[model samples]
Target: MRLLILGGTVFLGRAVARLARASGHHVTCAARGVSGEPVAGARFVQVDRDHPAGLSALDGERFDAVVDVTRRPSHARHAVAALADRVGHWSYVSTCSVYADNATPGQRADTAKLTVPAPVEVDNPVGEHADFYGPCKVSCEDAVRDGVGPERAFICRAGLIVGPEDPSDRFPYWVARLARGGEVLAPGTPDDRVQLVDVDDLAQWLLYAAENGLAGTFDGMSAALSRSRFLAEVAAGVGRPDPELTWVEQDFLLARDVRPWTGERSLPLWLPLPEYGGFLARDVTDSLAAGLRIRPIAQTAARTLEWIRASPGDVKAGGLEPAQEAEVLREWAARQ
Candidate 1:
């Protein structure tokens, strides 16, 4: 099958491109031309998605399907329209956050709350209207359903996506923190529900959806594990004792002032109010139906540690090895 994967330089997008190529599909990747060099067999097309050049450059190219991962609702509403009449099937990468009510635990994909309606005016930015980014993604899902009706559209709503090449440093922090003997901060209750899809599983299901001609919103969740058990594996991976971890109350965490995030809100770097509401609570039974599988938690931790050790020179470096992080923790103890 011929395929086009938008944005394959990092994270899930990169995994998709590699998997597609290995499966003997003709694959091409389009991006903003910032990161990642071209893959050996696949073609790399770089065009700013907003600029006329980005959309116009692909005027002549054709594919059976286009995986719209890089798109926000504003950009996707326009981009998918270009392919609505041409592409065989359109799969939009969406977040599970699109669910109207995420604070509640154990909501299935089929739940009424999961499907957010498209806004009356999609042209306006959606993020501004939604209380959190979840609603913003809801608007994006609406655009895709608009372009290609439910029968031909695939909404791959992912839970927390973590694995190799994790650029954001969100999950990696917990992994590395436990690896080095440090006082770990438990953001919320250890048993608080958390779900994540490994990058490999995400790519596999995405390609399967495009190939099978199947279309529906699939909640892609690979594993459901508590925070305490998750980090314990990381500690074991690096040959460390299950180091001490202080389970801080959620309200206490919110009360303590922390650094600002990006150009937006100011709160705990990890538990910002808007983000905390969504991530602090999530359940993804629907994603399991989509064939999302995870390596054992212990295995996931071991591999993450392995990747960190192998890629020490990487800019996103520092996951335990070198003894530096451990030394810092020791100094903090001395000061305490």
Candidate 2:
């Protein structure tokens, strides 16, 4: 089968391109080659979908399956317009963020309401992390569905895709931090739910879906696990005994101005809002039934740690700094 991966230089895109190549599919990765190089064994096409030249480069190309991991709705619309006529199946790697309700756990793909839709022609100039990310994805999904119709369109609403080569430090932060072997500051309840899909696993499943002609939306994530269990699994993957964890209350962290999810002072993989209670606990029953398989959490953690060790400089930007964590712990202890 001939495969085309849009934005195939980093993380999920790289995973799919490399895996598809190994599986004997003739693969082509189209990207600007700025973030990272395309996976080896796949043909490379330099196309910045934001520019007219990028769209022109794909004018004569054709493929059996096209996996688009674009964040910008405008880019998604452009790619659809360029390749819809030639491609056999269109797979858009969307996010769980597209859902309107993070408060409700176990909502199916069709049952959940989506966020505000963005205009297909409007580019997210503020960048991928802007507040418009989810809303724009709603539009992006629509663009693909509208372009190719539901029969040939595949939409994967993914959640917290983690594993080696992950650019986002959300899960990697815990893998590296807990590996240091100390009293780590944990956030929220011990039994708070968490779920993530390994990038390689997601990649494989995506290719499988496209190959099998499975169309329509599905939640691409694993079943939820307790937060404490998640941390312990990370420790085990790091080849260490369970490290001491100082479970901090959500209110305490909130009062001290500690943020959730990303940034330097934030605790990764935690959200205190009732609205987000189900963010990490999204239902993947349909995904799993449709051949979405997740690897063991420990294996994902170990591989992520291996990547961090290999690239120490890239590992420093995520999670709370040591001094900041210690300060928060000290204040918590004083209050006690």
Candidate 3:
């Protein structure tokens, strides 16, 4: 199969290109060559998706499938306008953020209410307009579906994607913390839910969808698991099986100004209850049934640890430092 990936330099896109190449598929990655390098074997075509005629370099090219992971609605529209007619299958990597309701758990992609698409005039939503991220993705999804029609389009609403080459601190924080093997600060209740898909798993599913010509939108993530199990599996994966974890209550953590979900002084993957109960607890039954294979969290964690060790510079730095965590634990114990 001949596959073309738009914006294939970063995380998910790079994973897809690497997997596709290993699977003997002829892969072509078209990007501006700024973010990161494309997979070693896949052909690279430097093209700027920001310009109107940027993709003209691939003018007469064709492919069996094209996967695009552009957050900008304009990029999506430009790709559709330029190559929708020639590509046999179109896969748009969207996000679960498009769902209108984050408070309700177990919502499926087909039944979930989506946010309003970005206004036709809005193209690049970033910085001060970062809230438009989800809405812009909605617009991009609309562009792909409308451009290629449902039969030839695959819309993947991905959740928190984590694994090797992850550009976020969310999952890696736990791996690093657990590897240290001390009084680890586990945030929220042990029963609090969390959901994420390994990058390779998601990439494989995307390729599966493209090869099999699977259509329709579906959430791209593994089944949700309790936070306790999430941490234990990660700990075990990183060779710290029986971690002495101190489960911190949300109220206490919030009171101390400890943030949630990726940033300085935050417990990554730990979100406030009720308000974001559904964010990581999505129902991916349909996705699993449709060829989305999820490996064990232990495996994902171990591989992520290996990647972090091999390329420490690549991992984003967030989450609580040791002193901050010790202070928070001290305060919590004092309150108790």
Reference-based TM-score of each model: 0.79, 0.96, 0.99
Clashing residue pairs for model 2: none
What would the per-residue lDDT of candidate 1 be over residues 1-336, giving only the tens digit for each residue?
888877777778888888999999898888877877546677887767775345766786678988887435666776776667778888888887677664555566666475454455543333565444565577778888887788889888877777667665555655666776756655566775556766877888888889988788877775556767766766776677577876655564344432222111121124434444455355565556555555665666666677767775552532323343344335445545
User: How much does candidate 1 score in TM-score?
Assistant: 0.79
Which candidate leads the pack in lDDT? 3
Candidate 2: 10-residue stretch with minimal lDDT: 120-129
Error of 3 at 260 (Å): 0.8
Ranked candidates (lDDT, high to low): 3, 2, 1
Error of 1 at 206 (Å): 1.0
- Point out the higher-scoring one by lDDT: 2 or 3: 3
Model 2 bad stretches (over 4 Å): 119-121, 125-129
Comparing 1 and 2 by lDDT, which wins? 2
lDDT of predicted model 2: 0.87
lDDT (CA) for every model shown? Answer: 0.66, 0.87, 0.94
> Top TM-score: which candidate number?
3
Tens digits of lDDT, candidate 2, 1-336: 999889788889999988998889998888888889887798988877877446687788778999998878778888888889999998999999898888988788978888889754456826544777888888889889999899999999999989888878698889988888877899988989998999999999989988999999999999999998999888898887678999889999999988899877889888886869879887788889999988888899899889998987765476788999999999988989
Q: For residues 23-133, could you state the per-residue lDDT of candidate 3 as single tens digits? A: 999999999998999989999999998898889999999999999999999899889999998899999999999999999999999999999999877777788778899
Q: TM-score: which is higher, 1 or 3? A: 3
Residue pairs clashing in model 1 are 219-287
The regions of model 1 sitting more than 4 angstroms off are 112-132, 239-241, 251-281, 312-336
Alpha-carbon runs more than 4 Å astray in model 3: none
